[model samples]
Target: MSNPKPLRKAVLPVAGLGTRFLPATKAMPKEMLPVVDRPLIQYAIDEAREAGIEEFCLITGRGKDSLIDYFDIAYELEDTLRERHKLDCLKALEPSFIEAGSLIAVRQQEPLGLGHAIWCARAFIGDDPFAILLPDDIVQAASGKGCLKQLADAYHETGGSVVAVTEVPREQTNRYGILDVGKDDGRLVEVKGLVEKPKPEDAPSNLSIIGRYVLTPEVMPYLSKLEKGAGGEVQLTDAMAKTIGEVPFHGLRYEGTRYDCGNKLGFLEAQVAFALERPDLADGVKTFLKKYIDKV
Candidate 1:
């Protein structure tokens, strides 16, 4: 309806304490943790840009100023590189650059939950449809179109809310927000309901919601209520679930490999997986992996 308002803004909720990373996250933001070479947040930002998001609001928290600084121009470093004719080095920094006024940051002020974190960006989102990309969940698209781009396209066609979903093991359904199937179309499933971290037997379906979401502004009001759900935290899933019948909501089976870099094992696996995707490092990384596996 009304042309879907043309999705342009994206919100990245990076306020988590990242207790899983502990000491490493004590000083550095977890979003700054490099997966292969680029920080995890970079991948999320790149994906948002690929989806035609022109502006971004980073839902940040205390000790997360580094996230903003990472996108700022390093004048001294750039000058030195320019003087030394290190064009390649300067070129490599392009992705980190954000045009003036294109990026903004808002403090979450509390460790409330994802819903509250997204609520903090209400002003930034205004009345426009927007996207939410979680940096901790780095999705590498198998089709070369970032996961958000895939969701964005679906949102344009359907003109409502869309979220990326993938089938997690039924036993692991408790680990994520599982979706209730309404209409099964193979590529997209109409969202009848959303259950945050449901027990295996209670889960409505194996398909679980991931980090990518294309949402209309309607969900913000639900988040504003700040009703604590599941873990006593204001869950974003709950907010989204509230809009199920009001807005056309669907779960998209996106083409991609999602890396949950929020945990230790997943983080390590992402490092190897991403490194293996790089042409410059693939051979060497493969050799090292083979040798290490042989020894193990």
Candidate 2:
């Protein structure tokens, strides 16, 4: 078989209203919410860059212009920083830079579903295998390779679509897309089928897909049909299920800690966890946490 085309592009679906964030998201897009000093969307872009993604297609909605503007060169701000000789501030902005035309943002037009959001970028993806990463699912890989890179590596060997997955509690199967396991080699499992948000008793296995996906262009035709599945939204899982036998599909068990920043508690937990990982703030944060524990 011919070698699979190198994955060059990534799609990020950022059209959600972020209802869980309430007043904070009333005006600001949730993707702009900072996990520390950097916004959440920046982390996702950083991950894609690490995986060798050269082009980015962001599925945006109304009031998400800020997401597009974040990657643009800030001429006024740079001029001010240069005049003030604030080299440190200028250096911090380096990571946000994207190649002149590498970034593209497409409007989703409605609050449909993840499937529809992905479909909106079909033109941007063209005929190449592409990746999809949800900004809300922030994954920190223990190997420092990022979750997308892990799936990309597996895709190279398997020559088909690969999705990052982790074992969730049996009772929590309904919260995610559960996979029907075929062959398991500990790290990679052959995907026989997929069930979107299946009841615990009906779930095929405990392993559930996360946000990182390396999908072939073949799935686009299925998504184009706009068939609504669970929750009355066009479901990506349902579309993917139709391609099970047509192409080689597998679930990769990535080594990482995933934070669901879409929820309030999870967002707070990620903030504290990320802060503790930084050498500059680890000691101070640990001391404050101890004091709070004593007070409580």
TM-score for each model? 0.98, 0.98
What tens-digit string does per-residue lDDT give for candidate 1 at 119-165? 99999998889999999998878988989999999999899999999
lDDT for model 1, please. 0.93
Q: 61 in model 1: Cα distance from truth in Å?
A: 0.6
Give lDDT: candidate 2, residue 131.
98
Stretches of candidate 1 off by over 4 Å are none
User: In candidate 1, how many Å is residue 188 off?
Assistant: 0.5
Tens digits of per-residue lDDT for model 2, 1-296: 25999999999999999999989999999999999788999999999999999999999989999898999999999999999999999999999999989999999998789999999999998899999999999997788789999998999999999999999999999999999999999999999999999999999999999999999998999999999999999999999999999899999999889999999988988899899889999999999999999999
- Weakest 10 consecutive residues of candidate 1 by summed lDDT: 1-10
Model 2 clashing residue pairs (backbone): none
Alpha-carbon local distance difference test for all models = 0.93, 0.94
Following a full C-alpha superposition, what root-mean-square deviation does model 2 have from the true structure?
0.9
